[model samples]
Target: MKEITFYLDFVSPYAWLAFERLPQALEGLSYHLRYRPVLLGALLKQHTNPGPAGIAPKRAWTYRHVSWLGHSLGVGLDMPARHPFPPLPLLRLALECSGDGFVNRFVAGTILRHVWQGGADALDPARLDALRAALADQLRQDEDAPERAKRLLRENTEAAAAGGVFGVPAFEVEGRLFWGLDSLPMLRACLDGDAWFDQHWERAASVPQGLGG
Candidate 1:
C-alpha cells in the first residue's frame, strides 16, 4: 500500500474537518495515513500567510465556503468568533502516535470533535489531562500513562518541524507536499495510483494578478 503523510495542527478548523473526512475518503485507496504534527508559525512565516482567515479576498469567501462545506459533509464545525489559538499540544500527540495507526486516528478524530463540536478548550492543560485519562482507560494503558502521552505530544511537534512540514492539513505522498484540506481528494487520487505527480509538479502558466491596470 502507498503511504500518505498528513501534517496537521489541531488548532485549525479546516484540519479538524479534514481529519474526520480523510478516513472515509481514503477507504477505497490502498494507502496508509501517517500523521505529522507541525507548527503553524513556521509555515506562515515561510509562506507569508496573512492569518487564520487568509487574505482579504479569500477570507471574505471562505466563511461561506466553510458553511456550505459543513452542510454538504454533515460535519459540525463551530468556528470561534475570534481566531482560535493553535492546537500545538493536541497536534504533538497526534504526531507521536503516527506509528500507532489506530490510536492516531482515534485521537485525531476525537480531539477534533472535542474542540470543534464539544466546545472544549483544546489548549487547556487540565482538559488534556482529562483526555489522557480517558484515552488511557480506553487503550488499556497503565497508571501514569497520561504523562507518557504528553511526552509523545511534545516529541511529535519537534519531529514535524524537522520533516519540512510548515503547515497544518498538509499532505505528503511519496515526499511531495500538498497543502490544505481542499487538496485531500487529489492526494487520495495519487495514493490510489492515478499518478497525479505531473499535474502538481509541472510548471503551469502563471496568471499575474493584483496589478493595477
Candidate 2:
C-alpha cells in the first residue's frame, strides 16, 4: 500500500478542485491519504514567491483558469467574496475536526465544499459558525484543541517546506513531491508504476542550475 500526503490551504481554489478530483484521478489505485492544511502564505514567503493571487493579472488568470478547471472536472468551485482571505480559522477548524494533524477524505471534502460551493465570504463569522456546527461531532472542543491545532498546522507547514513542497494541492508519494492541480495526471502516472519516474524523475531536479552572477 502507498501513502500520499495532501498539503493544501483552504484559501486555494486549485486545492479545492484537486481535493474533489483526486479519487477519480487516481481511480483503481489503492493509496492512503494524509490531509495536511498548511499556511500557503508562509510557504510563499519562504520561497520568495508571491503566488498566483499576489499579482493582479495572474490573479485574474488564475481565477479564470480554476473556474474552467472546475467546470471541466465536474467539481463545484466559486470564488469567495475575496481572494487571499485569512485561512487560519479554516485550517484550525479542519484540524479540530480530526483532533489531529490529518483529516480523512470525508472531513476534507466537507470543509472544501463549504468554501468552494458558496460564492459568499468564505470566512464570514456566521458561515464559520455554521460550518463548526456541521462538524461538531468530529470536532474536539477541549481546552487544548485550539492550541494543538495551531501547533500542528505550523509543524505541517514547516515539514512541507523542508520536504520541497512549495505549493498547495501538493501530493507527496514515497518522498517525491508532485505539485499543483495540473500535476494530477503526472501523479496518476507515478501511481500506476510508470517506468519513467525511475528513469527520469529525480534526474530532472539534479540538472545544474545556471545563474549569471
| Candidate maximizing TM-score | 2
Q: Positional deviation of 208 in candidate 2, in angstroms?
A: 1.7
What's the CA error at residue 44 for candidate 1, in Å? 1.3
Full-model lDDT for every candidate:
0.65, 0.88
**Model 2 ranges off by over 4 Å:** none
For residues 1-213, what per-residue lDDT tens digits would candidate 2 score against the true structure? 799999989889989988888888999999988898899999999989999988999998999999998898888788888877889999988887656588877778878888888788888899989998888888886888888889989988999999999989899999889998889999999999999999999798898879876
Clashing pairs in 2: none
Clashes of each: 2, 0
Candidate 1 local lDDT, 1-213, one digit each (tens): 777777776677778778878888777767777665565765667667666466776766776676678778998877544455666565545433443322456666766666777555666778778766655534533554446655555555566666666677888777767777788887777776675566645544244677798
Clashes of 1: 2
Worst 10 residues of 2 by lDDT: 97-106
lDDT of 1 at 143: 52
State the displacement of the C-alpha of residue 62, model 1, in Å, after optimal TM-score superposition.
Answer: 4.1
Q: How far off is residue 122 in model 2, in Å?
A: 0.7
